[model samples]
Target chain A: MTCATRIAFTLALATTALVAGTLAQSQPPARYGLGRPATGDEIRARDIDVMPDGRGLPPGRGTVAEGAAVYAARCASCHGKDGEGASAERLVGRNEGDSFAFATNPKLVRTVGSYWPYATTLFDYTQRAMPFQRPGTLVPNETYAVVAYLLFQNGIVKEDAVMDQATLPKVVMPAHGRFVVDDRKGGRAIK
Target chain B: MKSSRISRRRALAAGTAGIVGAALPASARQNPDTTKVQGPPGREVGARSPFEKPVRTAFSPARTATFTPLQDLDGIITPSDLHFERHHGGVPAVDPQQYSLLIHGMVERPTIFTLAELKRFPGRSMIRFIECSGNGGRAYRLTTPTAELTPQQTDGLTSTSEWTGVPLATLLREVGASPKARWLLAEGMDAAVMTRSVPIEMANDDALIAYGQNGEALRPEQGYPVRLMLPGVEGNASVKWLRRIEVADQPFMTREETSKYTDPLPDGTARMFSLVMDAKSLITEPSYPDKLEGHGWLEVRGLAWSGRGRITRVEVSTDGGKSWQNATLDEPVLPKCHTRFRLPWQWNGGEAVLMSRATDETGYVQPTTAELMKVRGPNTQYHFNNIRAWQVGADGVVRLAGGAA
Candidate 1:
C-alpha cells in the first residue's frame, strides 16, 4: 500500500475506536442477575387484578338475593341502606337525563350509577378494597353479590340478576357510553 | 477680661464632658456579645430553627393530604420534610430488611428483589416534580373568590425532589420482559392497596424504583423503603410503598385510574388516562395575604414547570393580560424539573394585576382559565394548569383576582 493510503487507514481506525469507547461508557450492561426468580405460587398469591375482558377472574357466582344479604350485613353501615351514601360515597342516584348538567352542579353528587363507565371496575374494586375496615377479606362470590346488588339498585340490572365472571362483563353500565379516551398530546393546541 | 476668661473655661469644660459621654457608650456597648452566650449542645441530627417550619394544611376528615407551603419555599428543590403528601390510606411503615418487590407475568424470569438486592444494581438519579392531577380543585369552586384563596391552598399539591434509585429498565432487562407486554400494574402496600396501570414504554424510558429522596433514605410519608418514580407523570401514577408489579398486555383499569382520576367533560363523556401535567406557572412572592410596604422596586419571583419537557420561556404580565415581557429563568433548567423565574418591577403605588404564562420546550403554552374551561368544561376536575392572576390594590394588599372561568 502507498504511504498516504496507509496513514489515512490508521486515522480512521483510531476514530472508530474512540467512538466505540464512548458508546460503551453510555450504555448499561444488559443484565445484573441481582434478584431471585419468583415461584409460580408466589405470583398467584398477589396477582389478583382483573382486566376489562374478564381476564384474571376467579371462578365464582352470586345472585342479587344473596348480594342483598351481604350488603345489609357488611356494606350497609358505610354505603347506606339504599345506596344513598351515609359516611362513605353514594352508590346510586342520578343515572338518567343529562349527565353534563348534573356534573357541573357542585351540589349534585357523583356515584357509581351516575359516573362510573365500566361494570368490571366495580367487581375489581370491591374485591381489592371494600368493607373499608376489612379489605381483601371477602370471597369472590361475596364481591359478585355486592356488585350485583349495587347494579340492581342503580336500575341497570333486574332484581333477580346473577353476576359471575361470564355474565358480569355482559352487564352494561348506564354510563358506559359516556367515556372517551384522552386525545391530548403536548402541543400549542388546547385539545 | 476676667469674666470673659471664666466663660471660655466653662465652655471648654462643657465640650470635654460631651466628648467623654459619647466615648463611654462606644466602650460599654456590648449588647450583641452579652446575648451571644453559648447555646445548647447540638443534637445528633440537625433541624431547622424552631422559628422556621413549612406550614402543613390537611384536607378531608381522614386527613388524607398535607399540603406543602409553596409560598414559603425559596428554591426549586423542596426539602424532603416539606414535600407535599396525598395518601388514600395512611402511610405504611415498611422495614427495609423485610421489604421485597415482586415482578411477575409476561416475563422470561419472574423475579423477587429485596431492598439490598435492588440497590446492588446500577443506580440513576434525577430531579423531577410530582404533581397531583387534582391540584387546583378548590380554584374551580365559584363560591370562593380569588381574593380569599392562597397559593398554598391552590397549587400546593406539587413538589420536586432529587430521587435516587435503580432504573426500572435495568431491572426489567434483568428479569427479561416479554415483547408482548405493553403495560404493567403497580400495587402499593398501603391500607387501600392503591394500584395503577403504567405503560411499559414509560418503564423502559426514565422510570425508577426509588429508594432515596434528597440524598437520604426515603421518608415514611414519601414512600419509606421504596416507591415507583415515573418522571413528569401525575403523582398517583408513581405508586408509593410499591410492592408488586404485574406485566400484562392491557391496562388493568383499576379503581384509581377509572373511577377517581378520570376527567369529566361538558359532553357527558369522561377522559381516561390523561396522565401528563401541562405547562404551569405561579407567582410565589407578593401573593395573597402579603401586603406591600411601599410598592416600589419589587422583584416578582415564581416557579414554572412542564411534564413534557424543559420550560423554554416564562412571561409576566403586570397589567393583567394586556401586555407581557419575558422573565429571566434560573440556571440549570433541567427537563421535567421546576425552573425558578424572576422579573423586576417598579410598583407605582397603583392598582395592578399580575400573572405569569409558561411555554415549554414542546411549544405548549399554558392556557388561561377561560381557555381551559372552554375545552374541559365546568365539570372537569384534574390537570387544571391555567394562568393564575394576583391583583395588587392601591392599599398595597395583594389578592387573588380572576373570576370563575
Candidate 2:
C-alpha cells in the first residue's frame, strides 16, 4: 500500500473514535427552562452564610474589650449582665468538663464556654441574628467584637486577642475536641 | 254520665304517664322543645359544630409552639388549622403575587422562579409527618406530675398532612446544580431568617417545595406561598416560608444546625446534623388525663412513624416493658407518614403500666428513655424519642409514668 493512503485511513479512524466518545459522554437534558436565570448581583446580595472552617468570613476585626462594650449595649439586656442569661439563652458558663455530665439536668445550663464546638459559629450567628429585637443590625466589626467578648468570657481567648478572619477560626473552642461527627444511621445501634 | 266517663279516662292516662316518668332517669326524659323543628342552615364557609371544636394549646408566650390536640383527632391527617406549629419567628403574611424563590450558588444556571412559574412544573403529593426534634422533651422532665400532663403536650409537635408541590430535585436539576454541590442552605423569609443546611441527596430523593397542604393552599402558619419539606427529618430542616436555596459544596453550619438542633453526647461531643428522626410512637387514646371509667373493653389507639421509612411493627406493652404484643396497623402505612395502630384491651380495673414501642422498616426499634440517656446523656435536649409509659391507677386515672406520682 502507498504511504499517503495509509496515513489518510488512520486519520479517519481517529476522528470517528473522538466523535463517538463525545456522544457517549453527553447526558439527556431534563430542562424545563421555566424560570429566568439569576444574575451575579442577585446571588451576591443573599449569599451571607458562614462555614465552620471560616470560608465565608467577611473582612473585620475586633478586640475583647470592644466586644464587651457591644455586649453591654446590645446583648446584655436579653442574655443578662454577665451572660448568665435573663430572658434569653445564657452565653457564658464555667461547666467546661461537666457540660455533658449534666446533659439531662434542666439546671445544667449550656453556654459558649461549655457546649459550643466552634468559635466561628458565634461570629456567624451573631452577625446573622442577634440582639433579639433588632437582628442583622450590627456591623461586621461590632459582630467580631461581640464574638471576641463572648469567647473571652468563656475563658477561650485572651482579653486583648484581636478577632479577625485570620485569627477567629484559629481560636479553638474548648468543646471542639468533645464533639463526634454523627455516626448514627437509622438502626438499633445506640451510636 | 258522659262527663264521668271522660274524667275516668283522663285519670287513667295521667296515672300511666306518672308511672313511666318515675321509672326513667331525668336525662332520658323526652325533650319537647328540641323536637320542635330543624335548625337554620349553615353559613357559606362551613364551621365545626360548637360542641366539636378541637383546639391546640400554646406552650410558650411567644406562641413559639401551638401543639395539636392529638387525642381529639380521629385519623392520621391533621386538619390544616389544627396542625401543630413551631416557628422561630412569628408567621409573616406574604402576598402570593409578589412571592418568588431564588436558586443560586454552585450551579450552571442560577434561576429566580415566580410562584406561578414554579407551579407550572409537574407536581407531586405525599402524605408525610413533620415533627419537631423537641416533640417529646416534656416527657423527660421528671418533676412535672404525670397526672397533669396530656398526650398533646408530650408528643403533639408532630402532625401529618398531604403536602403538594414540585419535587426539589426537579428544581435543582432545572437550575443545573454543579457536580460539586453537596449541600443546600435553605433560608426562610421570616424575621429570624431561619436557615438550615440540607444534604443535597435528600433533595434528590424526595424533598419537596411544598405549596399546598390537605387539599387547600398552604396555611399562613405553614409557609403560605412556599416551604421546603424534607419528609422524615426534623421539622426544622423543612424550613417554612422558604425564599432562597443556595447550593454549596459544604454545609453552611447555620445557627440552627450548630447550636440548637445538635444533640449533646455523654462523651462531651455534640452530634451535629443528626437529621433523621428515628422510629417513635405514642398511644394517644388511654393516655394521660383520660379516665378509663369502668375499664371493661378499651380500644387502645396511637400513632407510629419513622423518618427512615414505614413503621413495620408497633408493640404495645400492657405490663410495662416486661411483655410486648403486636398491635394492628391501619391501612396505607406510608413512609415518613403517621401510621395509626389499634389494640383491644380488657382492663380489670387494677394498677397497670401501658407503653408502646415502634419498629421501622429499617428494623430500628424505639429506645427507652433510659437507653437514650445511656448514649446521649441526660443533658441532651433535642431529638428525645423514647418509649412513653402511661401508668393507670386503681381509681381509673391514667397518668404518664416516670414523673411525680
Candidate 3:
C-alpha cells in the first residue's frame, strides 16, 4: 500500500476500535427505566411509573364507588362500558385453555389477564399512552378510577373494592407468575 | 457537508435540477403487472420500470400506496404502485410550495426549514421495510375461519421503498439540540392529527426527515413535503406529513402511544409500546388468488424482515407443519430492510400448505401464530407479528392456512 493509504487504513482501524469500546462501556438497559441511574427530577417528569409496591404512587385516592362515575365520563365508549375489550383493547378478561411452547403454529392472540408480567407496566403505559384520541389527558385520580374499573372487570377485584394509591399497587393480577421477563436469548429474556 | 455541485452522473439525480430520484431512464417503460416486463425501449422521455418508475394512476386524490398482485410478485420490493397503503383519514393534497418543517423544543435554535431548505442538505438513500405491527393478526383461529377474521383483517400494512432524504440527526444538529432533549413529539397533517412520541436519541442515531419516496417527491398518500422515517421502529410512530418536531425531556404520552399502539397481554396487563416488529416472513407467490394450476415447476418467493435487526435466515415448509427447508435469502440483508427470499418446489398435485418463517440477527425467531397467541393472549388487536401460511389446495388455489398463517 502507498504511504498515505497505509496511514488512512490505520486511522480507520483506530476509529472502529474506539467506537466499539465506547458502546461496550455503556450500562445495561435497565428494565422499565427502573435500575437506570436516573435523577429524581428526571424520574418525576419522565418515569410516570406506578410501582407494584406503591413506592412511586402519586398522592391520589379514588374509591371503586367513585371510579364507576369517573369511568362513565372519561373512558367508557372506546374501552367498552366495563373494560371488556370492545372496539378497543379488552382491558379486562383472562384467556383460559392451552398455553404454547415450541409450537410453531401461526396465529395471533393476546389479552390483558394472560401474558403481561408487571402491573406497573400497565399503569406506566396507560399514563403515558391511552385514550386513543386524547392521550395523557387523564389525571392521577382518573387513572386510578379507570384502573380500578378494569381490575373489577378482570374479576381480580370486587366491584365495590375501593382502589387508592395504597391499595391499587398491591392488588396483583393472577397471571403475574406466568410472565417470565424475556430472559430467553438474553438476560432480558426470562426463560 | 460538502460543496454542492451538479455532476453529469448526478444530474439525472442532480442532472443539475433534475430531482435526485428522477434518475429513471425516460424511454420504453416496462409493464409492472405483466409476467414479462419490458422497460421503455430507449431514449424516451417517460420510459420507466418498477425499480425507478411507478404507474401513476390519477385520482380525485391519489392513494398513498397501491397493492402488488400478490400473485405477480416474485421477490420483495413490491412494484411501487402496487404496494398497499393504510393511512388515517385519507391522503391529503399537499402543496410543496407551502410546506415547511418546524424543528423546536429543547434545542439551541428553534428554527423552521422549508421544503426547499431541507432538500439542500446531503441526502442518503436506503432500502427498508415498513410492515404494520399487525399485518397478519387473525391467523390463529382455524375452526371458524371467516367467522373469526375478515378480509380487511389481513394486510394492514404494505410497501417498501428506496427512500432518499435527509438524516434526522443532521437536522437536529442544525437546530442544536440540548443535552436534556430525550424524546421528540411528532405530529402529522392528516385529519386525525396523528401524533406520537419518539425517543430523540433514535433520531440522532439513524432516523430521517424524508422528503422523497421511491426516487421521487413524496406521494400524496405518503407524507409529502416531509415525513419522519424511524427505520425499525413501529410504523405509526413514523408520522407522515410530519408537521412538528418538539424535542423534550420525556415522551408526551400521546394518544397513539397510549390508547392504540399497545397490545393487552394475558396477565391482566397491557404490552405497551412493544415497538420494533418482530421478525416475520411471508410468501408472496402461491398466496391468496394465485393459482398453481395443478402443480408443476413453481418458484416460491417472499419477503422477510425484523425491527430488531437484519433477517439472518428464512425457512419454508411444504408438508403442513411436519417438515421444513431453508430458502435462498437475497443479499444485502440490511437492518430494518426488506430481504426477499425464494425457493423452488415441484407440486405433487395434492393438498398441501406452503409457509415461510424468518429469523433475524437478534435470534428472535418468528413465532407461529399459535405461539404468539400463547404469549400475548387471545384477544389481540394490534402488534401481531407472526409467521404466515398459504394453503395450496389440490386444484391449485391458495388461501391463508391454519397454525401459521
Candidate 4:
C-alpha cells in the first residue's frame, strides 16, 4: 500500500476508537439490578422528615390553646407542667434581651426558643421522638399543638397564634442566622 | 508518706499470696493441673475467659453513652460487643429478613433494598475509626477534672472496626442519583427515628452502608442489620439502624444537627456540620490507676488517629511540654484509622509529666489544652482533641496533671 493510504487508514481507526470511547462514557452505568423499585406508599410511609422549608410537613393546623391542653395531658408529666424541665430537657423560656452569651456564660439555658435554628424542627423531633415513653405516636395535629405550646411558653409566638404546615416553617427563630458552617480545616491553627 | 508506701507494699504482697490461696475460687485454686483432666466439649457460642474481665461503662446515669474500655484494648479493632454506644433511642431488635432501606427523593429510580439484596452488591471492607465529637470533652473542658480519670473515662467514645459493606456512592449510583443533589438525609428506625443531614460530597466519597463489623454481623447496640458508616465523621452522623435516605438539594436542619451537635463558638456564632475528628493521642499505659512497680527501661504506648488523614507522627513529651520526641508508629497505619505509637523511656523515679501529641498528614498538630481552650473558649463543648498530660509521682504512680492524688 502507498504510504499516504496507510496513514489515512490508521487515522480512521484512531478516530473510530475515540468515538467509541466517548459513546461508552456517555452511556448510563450498568446497575446491579438487585433491589426493587420502591412503591409510592412505602416511600410515603417512611418519608416523615420535615425540612426547614416545610417540605415534608403533613397538612395540619393547631392553636396555642389546643397545645396547652395536649401538653398537660400527654407531655407535662415528663417535660414538666410548665415546660421548665422535669425528666427531660427544659423546653420553655428565652432570655429575650440578653446577648447570645452561650459560648461564654455557663448560666445560659438552651431552650427551644434560644438555640434551635428552625421552628419546623420542633414538629419533626416531637413527632419522631417525644414523650420519651411513647415515640412516633402523636398525630400530626397533636405534634403541631405541642410545638405551638412550647413556642408560646418560650415567648416565641403569641398565645392566639396558630401553628400549621404553612406557618410553622415561616416562624423565624432567634438563633436562625446565628450559625456558621464549620471553618476548622485541620491545619496548624488550633481552630 | 513512708507508712503509706509500706502499706502499699504489704497490700501487694497480700495480693500475690491470695492469687495462689483464698483469693481464687475452690475450683480454680484446686485445678492447677489442666493436663490431668479432660476439657469440656466446644459450645455453639464462645465466650471470653472467666479470668479476663474487660467491660464497658456508661458515662451517664441515663445510659445514653456507653464507653469502650480503651485501657483494656490493644491493637485497633474494638470487640463488636464492647464497641462504644450512644443511642438516642434504645437498641431496637430488628429482624434482618424484614429490614429494608428506602432511597428516594432526587433519584431516577427510588428503590428499596432488603438486607439480603444489600449483601448481593460488590462488598468492600475497611479498617476505620468512628469517634464521637464529644469524646475527651470532660478532661479538655476541665469539668470534674480529677487525677483518678482513666484513659477510658477521659476518651472512650472512639472505636475502630473492620467494616464490611457496599460503598454509599455505589448505592447512590444504582439509584441514579441526580447531578443536582447536594445532600442526603439518613434516618434511623429506632424509637427516636434519629436523623442527620450529610453532605453529598461525603456520600459520594468513602461513605459505606455497613452490615458486618469485625468479620461478623453487627451487634444490636452497634446498629444491627444495616447502618451508614461515614469514615472519619462523628459517630452520631453515621445513623445506626439506617432505614431511609432522601437525596435533597438542601439540608433538612434536623434536630440533631441544629439543636444538639452544632458547636457554639466564643464569637457568639455556633458552628454546624463540624464532622471531621481532629488528630489526637494519649498514652494509655502508665496512665491513671496503672502504677509502676519500679522505674527502669519502660515502653510507653498509646493510640493516635486523625479523621483528615493518616497520623504522620506522634510526639511524646516526657518533660511536660518542654521537649518532645517522635514515637515509632506501628505498621498498617491506614488513613482514617487508629495507629498505635510506642516509645521507650528511661524513668529515673523522679517526679515527671508525660504527654503525647499527634500530627496528621494534613500538618495539623493536636493542640495543647491551653491552646485549644484559647481558641475554643472555656465554655464550648465537643470535639476536644487536646494534648492530655499525665503526671508521674516519685512513687511511680501516674495521674492526670493538675489533679489531686
Candidate 5:
C-alpha cells in the first residue's frame, strides 16, 4: 500500500474507532446494515414510528369519552364493540404471568394491560395500523384515547391516568420484566 | 516487519470500511462484472414464460402465499405460486404509476424516483434465496425422514427468485450520502408499519430496492411497487412494500427488531439482531409427511443453502450424524440461491437417521445442534439449524424421533 493510502486508512480507522467507542450503543444507518440517514422529507413522508418513550409522539391527547365514540365509528366492526376485533383482531388484554395466545378466550385476548410490553406501542401500532377498515386515519388524540381505554381494561392505570406523551411513557407495564435481550453467539455452546 | 504491519493494518481498515465505503483499495475492489450481470430474460425460451398465467391448484383455495409442491419440485426455485406468505393484514393493492421511492437523510440531495425512473437506471438481476429466518422449525420428530412431511408443507419455507433491480449503490451515490452515516432504517407501508435497521455498508454492497420478482412486477405479498432487496441478509431486513429509507447514525430499535425477531442464546443475553440465517439443509424428497413406497433405487435429494454466502459442500448421513458421505451438488451453485444435492442411496430396508450438513463457500461450515449448542449454550428454541433426524421404523413407517414421532 502507498504511504498516502496508508495515511488515509489510518484516518478512517481513527474516526471509526472514535465513533464506535462512544456511539457503540446506537450506530448510524450503516452500522445496523442500512445505507444512509433519512432526509427530512423522507422522514416526514412516513415517520409514523412512536417510541414507547414518547420520542416520536406528535402533539395531541384524548379523553376516554371521545375514544368511545371513535371506537364505535371506526374500530368496532372488526375489533368488536369494545375493541375485541370482530374477525379482524384482538385489541386488548393480558392475563398476568401468562404467555400470549390467540384462541384462549375473549377475556384473555382483549386485555392490552397483560401482553404488550410498552404503552406507546399500543398507540403507535394502533395509529399506524388500526380500525382495519381504515388505517392511519385516527388523529393523534383518538389514538391516545383508544390507548387509554385499552390500558384501563388491562387493569394497568385507572380511568384517570391520561394517555398522552407525558403520561404514556411513565406508565410502568405489568409484563415489563418478562423480556430479556438476546446474547447468544461468538463461542462454543455451554451446557 | 514494519512494512508488513502497515499492510496488515491497512487491509483490516479496508475490510472495516466495506465495499460501499467512499474510498476502496483500487486493487482489492473488483470492477462490476456488467457483462455476465443479468436482467429479466426477455422472452422465455419456451419454458414457463416470466409472465405466465398463475399456476392453479384444484384442491385448496388459500390465496396470497401458495404451497409449493415439494415432491414435484426438482431443485430449490419454488414455483412462484407455491412460495409461502406471511403478510400483515393481507397484501395491499397498489398502482405502479403511483409508486415512487423517496431517498432522504444524510445525503446531499434527497430524490424521489418513479417505478419507470428506477427501471431507467442500469439494472442487474440476482438469483438469491430470501428464506424467513424461522423457515425450518417444524419436523424435528418423525421416523423415516421422508415421512416427515408432504413435499409442499415440509419443503416450503425456502424459495429462490431471480430478482431484477437497480443496485443500491447507484442510488446511494446519486443521493450523496455522508461519510458519517452508519445506519439505515427501512420501513414497509404495510398496516403493521414493519420497520427495521440495516447496516449501510451492507446496503451499499449487495442491497437492491427490487421492484421486479421472477421477471414481473413485484408481487403484493413480495412487496409490490418496490421493496428493499438485501442480498445475503435475513429476509425480514428486506422490507416489503418499501416506502421510505432514512440514513441515520443509530438504530431505530423498531418493535420487530427488538421484540420479535431476536433469539435467546444459552447466555442470559439474547441475540439482539441476528440478521443472517445460518446454513441449513433438509431432505425434500423423502422427508416427513412424505411416504416412501419401497427402497429399491431411492434418489437422495435435498436443498441446501447458507445466508453467509454460497454452498460449497453438503454431506448426507443415512445413519444420522454418523458416517456422512458427500452428496453431489447440482452444478451452478449460485451464491445465495438454493443449490440442489442428490445422492443415490441403496436402502435395503434398514433403519437409519437421515441428516444433511451444508458448508458455505466462505469456509464457515454448518455445525450440528450439538456443535452449535457447545458455543451458544443450550435452550435455544428459535433459529435451530441443527442436523434434522428421521428414523425409519421396521414396519416401514417414517416418523420424527425423540418421541416427537
Candidate 6:
C-alpha cells in the first residue's frame, strides 16, 4: 500500500465512524417493556378506518334501489325527504356545475356530491356516524347502499350501479382533484 | 394575595354581623344568615360556591358544542370544568377499568395498553391550549351581527390546562413503529366513533396520550380514562376517548379531515390538513356588557396565544386600528400556551374603539378579518383567528364593533 492510499483509507474510516455515531445517537431509545402485545382479533375489531385508496374496506354489496329504501327509513327524517337536507346539513346538491364557487358565493351549499373528495370517506363516515341518533347501527351493506344513494342523488353514479368494496373505491368524486395540502408555514402569510 | 386577604377580612366581618342578625324570627330564615352558624361538614366531594355561578353556553342538536365562560375566568389555566367542549357524539360514559388503547399497524409489535399500564410509563406535564378551529366563526362570518355579545359568545372555544400524560413517542417506541409509517389514524370510542389522521411528525414531537387534566382524572366530557393530546393542533384531531391508533403510510382522509375541517380557498381548492392555529388575541375585558365605572383609568386585559410558538408581543389600539401600543405580557408566557396581556387606558368619558393584535415568535402578526378574507376568502370554514374590535360609547357602554360588524 502506498502512503497516499493509506491516508485516504484512514480518512474514509473516520467519516464512516462519524456517520455511524450520529445515526446511533439519533435512533429512538430502548422500549420500557410496558403494555401487552395486542392480539390479532383485538386489532381487527378496532382497526376500522378505511383509507382513500380502499384499504380496510369490509366486504359488502348494495344497489341504488336498495339504498333508496334505507335512505327513507333511516336518513330522510334528518337529511330531508329527498336528501335535500332539513334539520341536518344538505346531503344532495351538484349546483354551480363544477365551478367550485363555494368560496366566492356564501349562499352555495357544500353537499356531499359537490364537496366530498372521496366516495370511500362517505362510506367510512356513514358506517361510523350516521342515523344521527343511532350511529354505527347500519350494517356494511346498508352503509354501501346509503353511499350509493347519496352518490346517485348527487349525479355522480348511475341508478343501476351496484356498490361493493372494489367499485366503491373506484367511483370517482366530482371534487376528487379539488383538494390541496395546507401550504402556510406561519410566517407573515395570512393563508 | 393582597386581594384575597381583603376578601377574607370582609367575609369575617360579615359573619360577625350575621351572628347578631341570626336572632330574628324563624320566618326570617328565608334569607338565612348561614354565616353565623357552623358550615356544613366536608363531604366525599366538594362543590363550587352556590353564589358563584358561571355556566357554559351549550348550543343545539345536543351534540354540537358548549362554550366556556371566558369572561368569568381569570388567569391562564382554565378550570377543568370550564374547558370548552365540542363533541360529534354526545359525551359517552366509559368505564376506565374496562378501557384499553390499541396501537397497531405498520409496527414491529402491535400493543394494547390498559389505563393502568399506560400510567406506568414515565409521565410528563405540560401547559398547552386546545382550541376549536371554528372558535370565532360566528363573529368572523358576521352570522351573528350584533353588538350584544360577551367574551364567551364571541370567542370561548379555546382553553388552557396543565395536562399530565405519557409521551406518544414512548408509546410508539414500545410498539416499535415502522419507518414506513407517516400517519396514524386516531379513533375514539364515542357513539360517532370519531377518527382523525394525525401526521407522524406530531407523534415524534410533543404529542401525549393524556389521562389526566389539571391534576385530576379526566372528565367524561373531556375524554375520560384516555385521550390523545396533540399540543397546538386543532382539538378535533386530538381524538378523545381514544381507543385505537393505526399507523399508516398515508393519511386516512377521515370525514373530519376532508368534508368537515378543510378550509375553502378563493382559488377553487380547499386546503386539507390545515391544522396549526395562527396568532390570535381577544380583549376579554372592557368589551361588550362590561361598562366602565366612572372611567378615570381602566386596565384592558385579554389573552393571546399561538400554535406555532410563544406570543412575542400583543399590540393594543385604543382608537381602533389607527394607532398601536405594546401591552405588557404576563409572566410565564409558555410556548403554545395562553399568555395574559394587559394595558392601562385613560378614558375621558369619550367614545373610543379598542382592539388587540398578537405577534408570535415566528414574526407572524395576527391579521384582521379583511386581510384574512383577501387571501382565503370569507367562506373558509375554520381557523378564524382574526383581530376583534370593541367600541365604547360616551355613555360608558361598550359594544362589539368594526371587525365582525
**Displacement of the residue A33 alpha carbon in candidate 2, Å:** 0.4
Model 3 Cα lDDT, one tens digit per residue, A40-93: 453244334343466556777665667777777767787777766565665665
* Tens-digit per-residue lDDT, B1-405, candidate 4: 111221122222112232224544566667889898776699999987655556678866888888777777788788988899999989999999899999999999999999999999888999999999889877876644446777778898999999999999999999999999999999999999999999999999999999999999988988998999999999999999999999999999999998998888889888999999989888887677666666577777899999998999999999988999999999999999999998988788898888999999999999887777777777787888889888888888777775211
The whole-model lDDT of each prediction reads: 0.83, 0.83, 0.63, 0.86, 0.65, 0.86
**Candidate 6 CAPRI category:** medium
Which stretches of model 3 miss by more than 4 angstroms? A1-191, B1-69, B141-153
- The residue-by-residue lDDT of candidate 2 on B16-73, one tens digit each, is 2334345543444554364675555778888764334466778777888898888777
Model 6 ranges off by over 4 Å: A1-29, B1-44, B61-63, B143-146
* lDDT of model 2 at position B44: 86
DockQ per model, Cα: 0.53, 0.42, 0.05, 0.66, 0.14, 0.61
> Any runs in candidate 2 off by more than 4 Å, and if so which?
A1-29, A96-108, B1-36, B143-146, B403-405
Model 4: colliding residue pairs: none
How much is the lDDT of residue B136 in candidate 2?
Answer: 86
What's the C-alpha lDDT at position B36 in model 4?
88
Reference-based lDDT, residue A102, model 6: 69
True contacts kept of each: 0.72, 0.73, 0.00, 0.84, 0.12, 0.85
Q: By DockQ thresholds, what CAPRI class is model 3?
A: incorrect
Instruction: Encode model 4's per-residue lDDT on A42-115: one tens digit a residue.
Output: 99999999999999899988899999999999888987899888988888878746456677787888889899
Candidates in descending TM-score order: 4, 6, 1, 2, 5, 3
lDDT of 2 at B95: 93
| lDDT score of residue A114 within candidate 5 | 54
Against the correct fold, how does model 6 do in TM-score?
0.89
- If candidate 4 were superposed on the true structure by all CA atoms, what would the RMSD be? 6.3
Candidate 6 chain A minimal-lDDT segment of 10 residues: A95-104
Shift in Å, residue B24, candidate 4: 6.4
Deviation in Å, model 2, residue B352 alpha carbon? 2.2
Model 1, position B219: C-alpha lDDT score: 93
